[model samples]
Target: MSHASPAPAGITRRQALSAGAALCAGAPASAARRKPNLLFIHTDQHFAGAIAAHGCADVHTPNIDRLIARGVTFHESYSANPVCCPARTAWYTGRCTSESGVVQNDRFPIEPAMPDLGQWFGARGYDALYAGKWHVTGRDFTPSFRVLSHGHGLGEHGDATVARAAREYLRSRRRTDKPFFLSLGFLQPHDICYWVFAHTEPLAALPYPDLARELPPLWPNHGFDAREPETFRKNWRMGRIRQNMERWEEWQWRYYRWSYYRHVEMVDAHIGTVLDALAESGHDRDTAIIFTADHGDGMGAHQLWQKMYFYEEAARVPFVVSWPGELEAGKQDRAHLVSGLDVAPTLCDLAGIEAPPDCRGRSLAPLLRRKPVEWRDYLVSEAATTGRMVRTAGHKFIKYQGDGTEQLFDMRADRGEMHNLAAEGSSAGVAADHRKLLKEWEAHLSPSPAGRLTGTWDG
Candidate 1:
């Protein structure tokens, strides 16, 4: 749990002192006793296991590792709705995808009545500022935070530009009069989608050298599962049938994996830049930083290419919360199931502000303080309207709405999710229990519009 890493090389004494003074300046004596500043750093399509500190051996993420070492890491964190807009909406609104009415990507706008994270914090006198990707709705961000960046367009050097904007904000403009809630959203590994699209040509046709030895190995569960739900199978088949990427050999897949990790590393470097700025600004100790992703990418798992699936590689995300002296450090919480839905409520609770009335998530502030607290018995995640998953201590159950195809895995034994226990007669009772849990969860969801439920599966 010790964050004992060496300081990143090349930082100057003057830069550090100036940044620190800026953070501590102009604070009213009363404001000194107020809430800690909140820094929420979000990434797009970053797999939970891709970080070195999180058990992946193939990728290097020194920055992420340092952050993890300084905080409690949530090993079981998941995206409640594993798509871009839906998952992000859950993070901002503290509501499930169905409740937020954004069940898929680029389709549903958050209803005007619901208060987003920025509005909620801004109402409490925090200067809520947002930078980087804001895909929850259309271009107008006036109702949210004080918008710091515009559009989804990548800047020069991509994520580095986003980090530069954030660093500049911290260094030059951050207000010391009140606690600030800054959300930095970086887009990187999501670029792997463009990579896939632009690299449809055969590897032989490209000019790259053989990299078999340096490439990542295929996932143990790389082969297709016969018992995968028909809806998922159809989606996967359509992707392959359209792109013909199924013709890629093992080495090619390995190369793709290698490239994905490089993108992750690229984003990690930008993250380091922002973190360094925070430390230099002197707010490192007084700021609560929550690091997580909107969702995850498949990273060649199950021979899949992108997200929108309930698979672990796509649904689970890296979640870490660090506030130097206030929260426990260097700890990993593997006992409870956590989700993107918990972020807003947890931040509000830590800041002593009230979350919106319709927020569904429970606060993790008690747990972060190492206090005994009651927790939910099961965790639920949605995939558009086609799939709903329920995960408990020992098992994971996935059901598809269209054909009633079910997948049940004994997570304790088959963490790879290779075996299908739902079809087996002996495991029927466990599946039934999970079914009941899913039903109870569904009962709480507000009804989706007829069009939203029947839209094309565009993943």
Candidate 2:
């Protein structure tokens, strides 16, 4: 197919042939009630706190703000595993890090039997197409998606190419009876990691001293709870950048934040183009847009530089689901706790298909459809090898294997997580409950047959 209307730009085996061919016998009659197309747009290292619409005053996100206005934004959603490969694996396979063997970035391969959304959807008659980043470790995007653009290394270079390709696809896509599942993996705000690397060493003076007044102030959690588990403390002091980050002057940290917000704005502009293209193509109403990130950047929170930590800055991400005129708009869902694990299940539910077997995440379709459903009371996120975080309605509990040192905080009163309530006698009951929940979660997992998770176990 030729894409000329504009730039806007995965396959799966067992997926060699089009499922649409099999459905042709029944497709003609159902042309009037066609399936809703799915547009799954994800970003890297973008936090909920970075968007202007999400109450952050740091940057202008007219595009994301508009998306929020057209959709339901979940303020409390989080990454399943606060790292690129693991979180994305959870998203595509609906499995936990342990189950997929992608315990960390570029570390391990996925279970062979696991089917990504592309393969699963394609088999069910959806045209599975992809553009931009596909960072699911060991699995080729070609096996699951029809590639649009492979995308560039840096968000500065790749994001525009991705946006243009997406715009072209939306504007000029061949109209088909079967719905299309287009997943656009954008690299952005994540580019701030490169910025951090460039400035690892302390500077004698601020690069733009005049802009000091404009740079955002350090996060309230800039000073973290020092009594962290070995998993977290080691992560803080792991690399040269992290070890040296603390010595950075207030201006330097603020400068880091100033640069991070710009990365957010950079992707926001491209997102705007994609949104405009969808509307211009007249598929805006019949399509559902699920926007989120694989994980979030530290943004200097806890004086941390990158991911692999369960700090709110790294774990928490923006999740917005929109289907214009079909669901409620401009609704902020701060009530339910959500996670990246929910991505696959929700998509399947919306398409009237049974969710993949043993899928760990709950579908938010009930909530989106205004159906009364029992919501999850807690959400879990993993970091590194042994780090585990269990977040309940009012508190967050963090622990690491073989580390007696644990941290707990009453999220309602101490959202900054500076205060440690784990050792306090008064909060022992809350801490115990959290421990039980984590144990139960671990018990339910049927871990991968081989790969990195094996080393994570100690008996």
Candidate 3:
């Protein structure tokens, strides 16, 4: 069988501009300035306390912790969604999952029509570069980057591939005077080390730090909550679901935690490799570096092992922004609620390009200066499945469609999400407020002329 040849390429700047304007009908014009180079470093399945600087002694993440020390780390930053592709799409596009339709893995490619961050930067004469996972789309779709090195397969040395490509780009940047945008996506912890290294070595043989592993406070103690939803059971991939720890061996939990830390350490090493290249190429000060993750791993929090929920363990991500003089060094911003969706406009602001007005996120540039920016007080997040969450300064509310069960917690008092305050009589107003916020948030993500719903998660 013969395949039809693709149409010829004749897309002019005028046509491209028209297409862009159509998508972002009221977006602002590009500002003229010297564009700063961007080095966006991202990882997969990274939890909030994964870094040693964040107080997780179980793993050694010296390089990442170093970045935190030299940059502004948003202590309470989180992903708009806690799944893989959806979260990543949100991060790059500055929009929610519903806007991009990348709510789950393999749902669909990121909307080609959208004005992506890289594409926006590239339009302003910055050389855009992409390396690593590229899980947002298959090879069929092309990114705005001038150079793309997408390593195929679930390669053993995926991080190495990313490091090598980033190093090369830095070396090339040394020779060129053109400003550039580099997106380095690393796939480490998501590699599933437990299944990869399970049988060959006993879980005990795996190297792990001697520090005690404290469990999250929200989950019911072992041998309780056997009535967890079937969706949670199926997604956890557990051999069996029981109310408590009696059915499962202690080795299971130990293995899970150890592998999670190990993978994080492995990626940290690769990050160091990239940082070394930057210093060697003398772009350390010139390039504004940002480190973040797509989403987080559950790691047995709430007795769940994977993401797709609104629990803190799954939703929150480590967010670090490093700019030597422009951004406050070693400062931690705790009051503001930032989202992965904010990444796009922030990157655009750094590159001196006008961010698409339709982009649902606002720039963090003002916040970086320690100025009071009216940031979103309530950040909304959604799952691949039918779940919606609203996070306020002191509370989080989740409504699971399968059962209409609501999860309410006062995050300020109960960071672990332990006590469900939804049923209590005293917290009725809080619950109602969160519900209204959830509706407003959902309306923004699901904008249409009428009120059509986007596709839902199969779970």
Best model per lDDT? 2
* Residue 23 in candidate 1, Cα distance off native in Å: 29
Evaluate residue 120 in candidate 2 and report its C-alpha lDDT on the 0 to 100 scale: 92
Best by TM-score: 2
lDDT for 290 in candidate 3 is 83
Q: Is candidate 1 or candidate 3 better by lDDT?
A: 1
lDDT (tens digit, per residue) of candidate 1 on 1-459: 001210001112343233223223322226347788999999899989889999889999999999999998998888877888888888888877666677777777777677888988998989898888878853255667887775355422557877887888888855456788998888878888887886655466334666556787777977766877777677765663335677877777778788889889988999999999999888899899999998898877777778887778898899999999988999999987788888887788777676665555656676787655545667788876667788887898888767778889988898888899988999999999988777665544554462246422222
Across 1-459, the per-residue lDDT of candidate 2 in tens digits comes to 011110000011121122112212212234456778999999999888899998899899999999999899999898998889999999998887777888878868888788899999999889898889888888998978888899988999999999999888777776765788999999998899989889988888988778878989777888876666665566576776666776799888989999999999999998988999998998999999999999888887778767766778888999999998777999999888888988987787667566676677767776787665545677778765547788888988877655545789998999878889987899999999988777666655666754344434322
What's the CA error at residue 174 for candidate 3, in Å?
A: 3.4
> Over the full model, what C-alpha lDDT does candidate 2 score relative to the true structure?
0.79
* lDDT, residue 61, model 3: 96
lDDT of each: 0.76, 0.79, 0.68
In order of appearance, the predictions have TM-scores of 0.89, 0.91, 0.82
lDDT tens per residue, model 3, 116-151: 666777777888788887666422325567555775
For model 3, the superposed segments whose C-alpha errors exceed 4 Å read 1-33, 138-143, 152-155, 193-246, 447-459
Q: How many pairs in model 2 have backbone atoms within 3 A of each other, for residues 3 or more apart or on separate chains, i.e. clashes?
A: 17
Backbone collisions counted per model:
3, 17, 2
